[model samples]
Target: MCLLLLAGRADAAPIGYSITGGSVDIDVKLDGVVIGTSAGVALTGDSIMMDTAALTLNALRIEIAPTLISLSTHFGGFDEISVESAIIEGDITFANLWSQDTGTPGLFSVGAGPLLVTGSWGATDSTGINAGTSGQPITFPVPTITGIIDASPGLRIDSVTMHSIEGTPFGEAGKHLTIVASYSIETEVSIVPEPGTGLLVAMGLTALAWHRRSGSGAGPAPRG
Candidate 1:
């Protein structure tokens, strides 16, 4: 789905994202603080890095759709927003587009300005449903991911850097691989409610009334 792009907000939730399933190493930081990082894991065909023709950073956006929080914990326990994958598609043109593990070429810098992230969120839980809604993909017995979002900047082309460590699957045992990125970060999270929750509630109330008036609970007093 299309993400959001708005000016900076003073009151926004600290946005967070995650990546899963890939044989790669990556670390993302906002300014100097590390928000998300990965050692050397083996993910399948995940994480896409594309290049953009826009020579300069003309626009920026970050977006995060509020997902379901498991309701089976303690009176609706602290469920986590699991991020399965991440798609970073923007235009980042440094100096060297191709390097062979010779230690980051020369001028290593990013575009100026606040790295605005759309799906990243405008505020934490600020965009979620505060009231109870219908049942999501999360059920009692077995649970499967109900939603998937691609916060992709959608501005692509090419560029990448790989670092192989020892003892990794691609090589020996203790070797691994990794990719790294750095930028000034400001984040926000939103609560994207299930559109069907409202309808579910209405139906439930109607059912309850019908049940109460079904048998003995039906009809009024005998005009007494």
Candidate 2:
């Protein structure tokens, strides 16, 4: 009976998670010269329950409120490059990568296979001449990102770090922009109990109550 109960518990559905709080670190450079920097923006997002045993990622989205960046520059007859209402988004794809026990029960580290991330940003010059989406949504090449899963006591993501470095074209020909971004997110999740599971729990409690009442109502046993 105990073994059967354990098996039933293991068959429960995957757990879902929500972004509690974290930080976003973004650095932009032109021709290898640091031009703009942003750190400490609040992050909010959600993730569908991923298979913990399989180490697979179904879907995850992280977003931040619009922020601004301005830099003094001489280009396109504009005195400065202004990026207003800039929002950053990060996404993850691929499945069934790697996982290992941290020598501690319910504490495991997992990674995504062929981890592909898509990011997007928008910017325009002061005159709005060099307008359009800032280049294109940067598609990160296959990179291995590691994160911790604290399953003991509860199922939760302690922290995860996503980092990438890539280059894209700039305004003038022959000039390029280097983007280095890192997002560190801390998350926690709650399990959504199935209806059947809840019903089963209620039934078990009722049975236990009946058994206790029956025992209490019984007359004292005769001396053996």
Task: Give me the candidate number with maximum lDDT.
Answer: 2
lDDT of 2 by residue, 1-224 (tens): 43357446646555556767776655556666767666665565654355556554444555654444554443333333222223332234455367777887667676654444444545556666655445445454544555566653222332222222233244356655544445666667666554466766766677778888999989988898
Q: What lDDT score goes with residue 59 in model 2?
A: 40
- The lDDT per prediction is 0.27, 0.51
Give the poorly placed runs of model 1, Cα more than 4 Å off: 1-191, 219-224
Q: Give each prediction's root-mean-square deviation over alpha carbons.
A: 24.2, 6.7
Candidate 1 structure quality by residue, lDDT tens digits, 34-153? 334544333222122212212222223222223222212212211122223333333343122231221333212223222211122111122344333232221111111111122232
TM per candidate comes to 0.19, 0.53
Task: For each of the candidates, give the backbone clash count.
Answer: 36, 0
Best by the TM-score measure: 2
Q: Model 2 misses residue 19 by how many Å? A: 1.5
**TM-score between candidate 1 and the true structure:** 0.19
